[model samples]
Target: MMTVDYRTLFADVHRRPGSYGLDGSYGQAVAFIMGCDAGNAWGLLVGFPEWLAMKAGGGANLVWSALVLRIAFPGPTVVTAAETLDQQHDEHAVGALFGLLDEFLADRKGSRGAAAIVSSYLDWQRLRREQNS
Candidate 1:
């Protein structure tokens, strides 16, 4: 599978001025996002609802939500990518985002990340059991 660095992808999205409704310290958000790794690197395209529940309260992401509601994305990948790009920032939200991403990426990258082409069925089995129980 092809790998994508969500951090790079989102940072680029942030680069465009007047394109977001983010509410936070720009430098700090950039710093935080740059430091995070979505498995292989910083940035990821997590579900929009997940982001909203984690961060947005009330209408924090109303603009993007409006857009998403009105538009039809090309596919699942496009929808996910759009969600990442359309993401708005909240200082509190971004911090929480990192904590969650770290936990998630660690599980995804454990062992396999150490060596390319590596597989860990034992680890997978443990995870499967955890998921089921």
Candidate 2:
């Protein structure tokens, strides 16, 4: 099986610049995308809010997002979790980001992850509306 070491990879990514002129490392990009301090980045794997902040652009995006996880589940299960999150909340913008983790994070494929995230976002939107009502 192919395994990714998140901390190491994050360290490397954070050290370089993005092709689109994103300055800083993987952590920086995540922090920028999330509007929170990337810090060590391990917390992101555990928190759904951070995941809600970003979308999947491609495999490169998934590599960084999933590798940060302390754990990784199969693509389908992670997508399911995102859908379940939707039942309680809505975060459609980043719907494409559910693909993720370490044992602390979920390992989802990019496409499925995006579906799960979109579902969660839809739920989030519903919750928001309910709250406003």
Candidate 3:
């Protein structure tokens, strides 16, 4: 499996603020996405044991778990924005969020790692839409 550098991923996300939302602040968005990804990943990992136990019968559990996980998590897991935005009042918070996301994305690998990144982005996008609506 290929290695993924989350710092780079965060930087990419930061650079592409237009993708997640119209705002130019990639840091805050990245932070939000990272938090969402962490939450989603935690849920998946926590459920793994139960999924494994249930599949011990004919290994069908494993297959089901894999399928569910795949759907729960998708590739290029980055955020996408369906609208535009303006500047924020606090740059410090944005910087801090960017830093946090950078750290989280730095240590991941393979599809799951990619999924985490993408998942976070989508979560942010969803929030942005709801807030605007």
* Candidate number of the best TM-score: 3
On lDDT, the candidate that comes out on top is 3
Candidate 1's TM-score reads 0.25
* Predicted structure 2, TM vs. truth: 0.28
In model 2, which runs have C-alpha deviations exceeding 4 angstroms? 1-11, 16-50, 53-112
TM-scores of all predicted structures: 0.25, 0.28, 0.32
Clash number for model 2?
35
lDDT of each: 0.38, 0.39, 0.42
lDDT of 3: 0.42
Those runs of model 1 whose alpha carbons end farther than 4 Å from true positions after fitting are: 7-90, 112-133
Candidate 3 Cα RMSD (Å): 16.1
Displacement of the residue 66 alpha carbon in candidate 1, Å: 20
Error of 2 at 35 (Å): 20
Model 1 Cα lDDT, one tens digit per residue, 1-133: 9865654445444454235444444344444344443453422323333233223222223432322322223233323222334344233334444444444345445553422211343344456569889
Q: Count clashes in each candidate, considering only residues at least 3 apart in sequence or on different chains.
A: 3, 35, 9
Over 47-132, each residue of candidate 2 has an lDDT whose tens digit, in order, gives 34434333321122243444233222234333322223332222321222322322213423444364475566566656756988
